[model samples]
Target: DLHNRFKRGARSYTGTCKDEETQMVYKKGQSWLRPALRSNRVEFCRCDNGYPRCHSTPVQSLTNDCFTGNGTLYRGIQSRTESGNSCLKWNSPRLILKTYTAWKKNAHDLGLGSHNFCRNPDNDRKPWCYVLKDNLETWEYCDVPKCSTCGLRQYKESQFRIKGGFFADITSHPWQAAITTLDRRSPGKTHFLCGGILIDSCWVLSAAHCFQERYKVHEIRVVLGSTYREKKEEDEQVFEVEKYIIHEKFVSETFDNDIALLHLKPKADSLQCAQETKSVRTVCLPDAGLQLADWTECELSGYGKHEENSPFYSERLKEGHVRLYPSSRCTSRHLFNKTVTENMLCAGDTRSGGKEGNLHDACQGDSGGPLVCMKDNRMHLIGIISWGIGCGEKDVPGVYTKVINYLKWIEDKRRL
Candidate 1:
C-alpha cells in the first residue's frame, strides 16, 4: 500500500532543448526518458525557461539517486557545501574567542560563575576565588566547587578558647557576670585568677596587664560558665591557650591600649550541654556613629574580691548597676584627666545620690569585661573594663575602652 501510494504521489520534471545547428525541438525527458527515470526515481532536468528542476518522481527516487547520482539531493548538497567551507563562519569564531578571552582576563567580573569554578575543596584550606558582595562591601572567600590547591585564608578576629572556667546561666539577664580576683599565692599550687568573659570559642579578650611575663599563655587555664568559686573546682570547663596577643600599643605603665587576646590551643566544643553548658557568648561592638550620651544607665558584674584583705571567697558572682557619667565629669577626676583619652569611656556617678554612691567600682581582673548600657530594653556593649586609680574610690570612675573606637578594626578582622 505504501509503495503504491508513493508511486501515485510521484512528481514529473519536464524540460526542453534544441539541436544547436538544426534548431530542431528536443525534450530532455520527453517519453522514453520519463518512464526510465520514473522507474529509477530520478527527477533532475532543465526546464523550458533554462532553469534546473529536481523533484521526487517515485518511492525509489532517493535510493536510485544514492546509487546512480541522477538527481540533485538537498541533504548531500548541504553536507558538501558545509564540508568545503571547513565548518567555519566569517565573524562568529572571532566573536567567541574574544568573549572567552575577556572572561579569562577578569574572572572576578563573572561573579558567581567564577566562584563556582575556583572554590577550595579541603576543609582546612582557603578558597581560591575572592567575591565582593554589595551588602558586605568587602572581598570574601568564595564557597563553591572544591579545589585542593588553594591558599590558606587568615582572619584578624579569630576564635579562641579560655580554659579552667565553669559555665553560668546568664540567659535570664543577658548580662554576663564579671568576676574579680585578688593576687594571692597558694603554696605548691597555681593561684586562681579573676573570672573572664568568653568572647568566642577560641579567643578571650582581657586586660593586658592582668597577666605578666610569668603568666605564660599555655600555663593559664580558662574556666567557662561557673558562678561559685568552689563550684569551679568540680563543675567547670577549661581550655588551654596556644598563644596570647597583647595589643601592639598596650602601655603597661599607663594601661593605654589595655586589651589582650588569648588564642586557645584546642578548639572548644560549640555544642551546648547540661553539665558542661556552652552559654558563653560575645557582645557585638557598638556603632561608631552612635553617640555615647544617648546611653544613660549601665550595669557591671563580677566575682572580684569584695575587700582587699577579705579571706572569704565569694561563692557566687556579684553584679552592680552603674550609670554612665558625663564626659565633663569624667575629665575632672585626678590622674584620669591625663589617662582617660577620648577612646576611653568612664562609667559611674560622681554626683550626689548616684547609683554607684559610695559603692566600690571595678577592680583588677574586671578589666576587659563589658560596661553594658541598656537601650530599648536591650543590652549593648558600650565599654570594655580598662582601669581606674583604685577599685571603687571616692570621686573616681571606672574607665573602659570605648567599643566604638574598635568597630572598624573588629569588622575587618571578622570578615570571612
Candidate 2:
C-alpha cells in the first residue's frame, strides 16, 4: 500500500523535509528513509542545505564501491544484473516465490525503494537482484567494482623516437585500439576504419567523423592488444560496440569537436570488456589544468597509411613523434584556412628537412587515436587524431581534438 502511494507521485514542496527514520530534518547528504502511509508516503526530495537531491548521490559515489560494511547501506541506482539483464523489481509479481519471500521479509533494509535498485539483502559480496528469463527466475550479482581495481593500469614509459613514424609494438603503446566495421557483403570480414585509444576497460575514444556514415553498433568492433593492422593476435581482445557518443556540436564541414566515444559491450559471462594484459592497458586521462610546454614532443600510434598517398593501411602499428606548436603558429591561416576552433590543437615534426626529407605526422586513417605526452613517468592523453594535411609534410602541422576541454563532458557522458 505504501509502495502504491509512492507510485501515485505524491509531492510536498513547502514543508521542512525530515528524515523518516530519525524524525529530524535531514542532514546534508543523508538519505531519507521511508515513513508509513500516515505521512502520505511522500519521499523527501531534498534538504535545504543543497547537497544533491535526496538519495540522488548513491552512497557508493561518496566512498568506494561499497559504502560501508557489506554495502547494506548502498543506495546506488543500478537496475541491471552483472550480465546486462534488467533486474526485476522487488515487488514485481514476476519475482520467483522464494526470492520474493526473502525480499518481503527484509524489504526495508534491502534498500528496495519504490524502484528496482540493486541492493544487498543478505550481505552477499555486493548488491544483487533477480531477473526473469525463459519463463524462470534467477538471481545474479551486480557490477560493483572493488576500490582497488577501479581505473588500475600499468603505465609504461615511452622511449620517444620516430622517423616518418617507425613501426611500433603493441607492448609499447598498449592503449592503442582499432575501430573496425564488419563488411555487409563479406559477412565475417572486418575493415579497419579508424584508430582508437582505450580510456577504460569498457570505453574507447575515437574520432567522430569516422562514424559519419552511421554504421550500426552491431556492425562495429573494437580491437585491442594487437600489433598487426589486420591480423588477430592470440592475445588480442575483441569487443562489439554497445553504443557510441559523438559530440552534439560536432561539425562535419569544419571538423570541429571531432571526438567520439565507443562503449564496449561486455562478454556474456563478465561485466568487463577489455582485460589488462602485457599489451592491453588504459591510458590515463590528463588533469584539466595540465599544460605541456610548447615544442614538447609527444607520441601517437595507429595502423594508418605510412604515407599520404599509400593505398594500403600499415600492416603493423606505427608510432610518430611530434612537437606541440605555439598558439601563434597554430591558426587557421597556418592550416589552409581551415576552421581551428578552441577545441583543436596543432602538433607536427618541426624538423626542417630538405626536399627528400620525411616528416613525422599522423596520416589519413589514424583519426580517433591517442596523442599522449609523458608526465610523472606515465602517458597522459592530451589529444585525439582529428584532421591533417598531406602526411609528413614539412611546415604543415596536423590538427587534433584537444581533450582537456572535454574532461568534464567525458565524465558526465560516461556516467549516463
Candidate-wise lDDT, in order: 0.45, 0.76
Per TM-score, the best of the predicted structures is: 2
| Residue-level lDDT tens digits of model 2 in 38-147 | 43333334454433243223332344334433467676555677789887777676663655432475455456534566778777757887878787888888765443
Clashes of 2: 0
Residue 392 lDDT (model 2): 84
What TM-score does candidate 1 get on C-alpha atoms? 0.50
lDDT of 2: 0.76
lDDT of 1 at 349: 44
lDDT of 1 at 300: 62
Q: Residues 1-416, candidate 1, lDDT per residue (tens digit)?
A: 44543242233234454322112233444211122234545333333432223343553443321211111111111111211222111122232343222134432222111111222222223232222234321223322222111111111122121111122234322224332332346532344565454445455556666765546554576655555544553444556666666666777776677666666556444332222132344444455676656337676655554543446444555555567877776663555556667777777644454323235466555556667665444456777787776655566777887777766654444342
> Which candidate tops lDDT?
2
TM-score of each: 0.50, 0.64
Off by over 4 Å in 2: 1-163, 354-357
